[model samples]
Target: MPLLDAARAVRENAHAPYSRFKVGAALRTTTGAVFSGCNVENVAYPEGTCAEAGAIAAMVAAGETRIAEVAVIADSPSPVPPCGGCRQKLAEFADGDVVVTMATTAGQSATLTVAELLPGRFAADHMGNG
Candidate 1:
């Protein structure tokens, strides 16, 4: 299935009682496996989970460490990009050239590479682990 379709499908399952702003994300791993997730809200706003992070966690739980492509969808006026934290999470598993597609329910969409999404991204090398 298309990543966008997957994301859209999962968006319906999002637990956004507080914000009512549901979001969904899907990612294709380097191994050709696809994983998807939806935003899960909590009473404590800061405890809410973003769709991208949930997708990444699902991918990691499946033992896939590399991402090839990603797609996210939301019901907003324009395409919605992942949050700062989620962007960094994506960078942790995807190369700079990996494509990230952000979309809106209205059909608007934007495509960018991970590098474009998070320029000057902090990496493991910054921790002197590389």
Candidate 2:
């Protein structure tokens, strides 16, 4: 549960004002390094950064590429899955079988693999190499 704990701890640091919907994400790299991030909203609305994206960026900045596990927590009635774009971002680094756990502050939770979250996801192989 360290991943979840990391996510929950970071959730408190979210910068959500307009939507007021805060989210936090934690990811474990294959090397066992853990990285966490919180959602940061922008005044421009859709230009905001997602918790998952932030975590992924942190992982990359730390020189880790493969994600071993993931957890995301949000203040919602039910476990909130990552946005469509976040799902793709996760897939870019994590394998299909990588587990992604979504949770609510109230303790409600759901789990799914990257493949389960995004079936028929577009992959780099889709683009033929020159």
Candidate 3:
């Protein structure tokens, strides 16, 4: 749960004044490098950055791809997984079976694979990458 802990720590920096709903994300590369990020909301309301996107940006900035694992934490009754757009964003770096752990600040958590979280996801193969 160290990843979740890291995410929770960054949640304090989340800029979510609009919704007052803060979120944090932490991701581990296959090489074991960890990157963390917090959601930054915008006044425009619709166009806001997600915690997962921030973490992915950090990971890419560190010159790494291929997410081996991910952890997301939020202050909710149940563990909240990444949003629909984030699931696609995660798929860009994570494999179908990559582990994604959703956690709540209250200690509740749920673990699932990317495939489980986003079944029938639009993957690289669909884009003819192969």
- Steric clashes per prediction: 0, 0, 0
Instruction: Go through the candidates in order and give the C-alpha RMSD of each one to the true structure.
Output: 0.5, 1.3, 1.1
Candidate 1 Cα misplacement greater than 4 A, ranges: none
Best by lDDT: 1
Off by over 4 Å in 2: none
lDDT tens digits by residue: candidate 1, 7-107: 99999999999999999999999889999999999998789999999999999999999999999999999999999999999999999999999999999
**Reference-based TM-score of each model:** 0.98, 0.97, 0.96
Report the C-alpha lDDT of model 3 over 22-129, residue by residue, as the tens digit: 999999999999999999998997889999999999999999999999999999999998999999999889988899999999999999999898888887678899
lDDT of 3: 0.93
Model 2 worst lDDT run, 10 consecutive residues:
121-130
User: In model 3, what is the error at residue 127, expressed in angstroms?
Assistant: 2.5
The per-model lDDT (C-alpha) reads 0.96, 0.96, 0.93
